[model samples]
Target chain A: MTTNKSLFLIPKFITTPSQNGVGRYVCQLQRVVLKFCKNHGSSRGIREFIEYDLLNFANKNPEVVVYLKPRRHRGPVIKAEYLNGDDQIVFCHNNTREEIAKWLNLLRTQSGNHDGTRLRKLWHTDYPSIQGPWTPYTFRDPALNLAEFPNEELSRPLDQPKTATEELDELFKKQQESEVAESSEVK
Target chain B: MSVLKRVQQWATFARIWHVYDATWQNPFQSAELLKKYLMGIHKPIYHPMNDCGDHVIVINSLDIALPGNEWAKRVYFHHTGYPGGATWTLAWELHRKDPTMILKKAVYNSMDGNLQRRYTMERLHIFPDGNVPPELMGNVSNQIRQIRPMPKRLDHYTKEEVEKFPKIIDYPKDYILR
Candidate 1:
């Protein structure tokens, strides 16, 4: 089969924004810069978000510094600077107040690190195993070490898949054997 | 268990080093344990779909223990995708062929069949013995406790130490000499 061509394979990790920290989390978003126009039709949603939701968001996340810049005739844009020295710019031309809020929330929650195209792993940790990792010799029966391979007993499957009817028949046979043994003991 | 503690846990993520010693431990249990790390089940942020697991370094693959007659009974099946190209290798034979294959297969089989399984397996570092490469040494942060204690070899003990070890009984003078 032919493999498809791809632009990237591995994901990229950022500097400061991390989800797997050592029992501590540092707020990654350092500051947010919002640029909007005073009388532009496209800037209406951003203006509404600023007027209504911005104050609450700022109050809730006191760690994040929020700045509002009003330009003469520019379209609205939101620029977020992360602690990792990366800046994410979201164009907000003709977006709604709810959409702006959603975008702002996304930026706030992000660790500022982007996994480029292919992620090597989803999770990363320092302490991987608590008990231990398994290996081939972990639970090996000592008999196998000394015995030769392809031996009669070991060469067969460890367990044969038994059906319910077979199990009942075995039980009946065991009961008959026990009863016969008791009768012989009485004699 | 408190709400405040829960909130703090939700906010903070800790990366810990885990080491798994494969000496004399069952391969099945080892696979189960590694699956936890591969699937990120050991972490608080573990979601079935999320990659939030830690790295696992397994040592002593050559000395790993297997239960029952699995050495000969267990078979690892493979296909070449060609006509009459199926192959079945016995567990012991596979181990002798490649010491790490048994453990790798066990851990691999334990994982859910998905694209993410490949990503999870990447975090697992396996070694046949104590000799770890320099590059992988940096990735290891902490060691997980051994499931089974390392069996002490007779050569490892000093003469005095072996003599000092308590004896079950002493031969009586009256007892018949061989």
Candidate 2:
């Protein structure tokens, strides 16, 4: 077997246009992944290190590790690359929706996260203030298969992918209502 | 809460200086050159010895811009390891949730790996709304000028907008400098 080179694309801290608690979870992830990668030794020959590389690689390899934080850490840390399916190993932190989608596509499931999936499913469905009701569009997905995407939506000349932003807004409204209802029930 | 005191302001005595708006800009998002620029980097100060301080007062800490397509897709994670395990949130959502967090993150990231970076970094002040504390600035209004992120300008005029009019294209009788 021919060996390939590994690369790194580590984003330090990720926050949004909205004010949200980056939460302690992502902070720790940044520390762990950076510290771990910093300590690990990497050889040469790495090429085209990017998200595109990882997504394609993951789609081709089932033996790849899909880590979403709950019970497992994302992996195949041994050697990473865009070629030879080396990009399949993703070191994602901050639990972005794209990462969730990547793992979901990799595991081929939606919503119902099994005990051992790539991403660590957050228990609190209600993400702090702004992190919830997952937004409708994302750019990075290590396991997104274009064929599985919504063809019906694209049947017409599409200008941009329309998201369920209104739906999410409604979800937040409902969540707020439920919270108010629960508070009144207790009162 | 409350911002820390401004500490001290040293007089400008260098040939070159830089200004940054971390509030409206991602300190880390700058290409390699911007980092070198902010660090007082492109200087012939030569020796890697002492610290050469520069002033960077970012206004409107709540409105720093981010790179393309990242606002919605990217998420930040943290893990406390309770039964709840890890937590994740998109950057765009954070802005909607709390606008100030992103700017602070940018300043920190921009200054990362710089020597004496922390001390120099603190000199930056960021606010929730787009407000700059002019009182602290005194008559230094010139120094407190708003930092506009360098926009890419195309200097090349289109063929239609050029001075190449039929007769005007001929050599001008005299050239004048603006």
| Tens digits of lDDT, candidate 1, B14-132 | 44335677878887888997788656686655677655677787878999889989898998999999999999999989999998889988898888798888888887888898777
Output the lDDT of residue B20, model 1: 71
- Model 2 lDDT at residue B178: 64
Query: TM-score: which candidate is best?
Result: 1
lDDT of 1 by residue, A1-187 (tens): 7665455565542333344365886778889999999999999999999999999999999999999999978999999998878888999999999999999999988877353445566665555667444332345467655653213343232345665545665776687799999999999
Top candidate on lDDT is: 1
Candidate 2 docking category? incorrect
Q: DockQ, per-model, please?
A: 0.02, 0.01
Tell me the TM-score of candidate 1's A chain: 0.63
lDDT of each: 0.75, 0.41
- TM for every model, in the order presented, reads 0.45, 0.31
lDDT of model 1 at position A70: 97
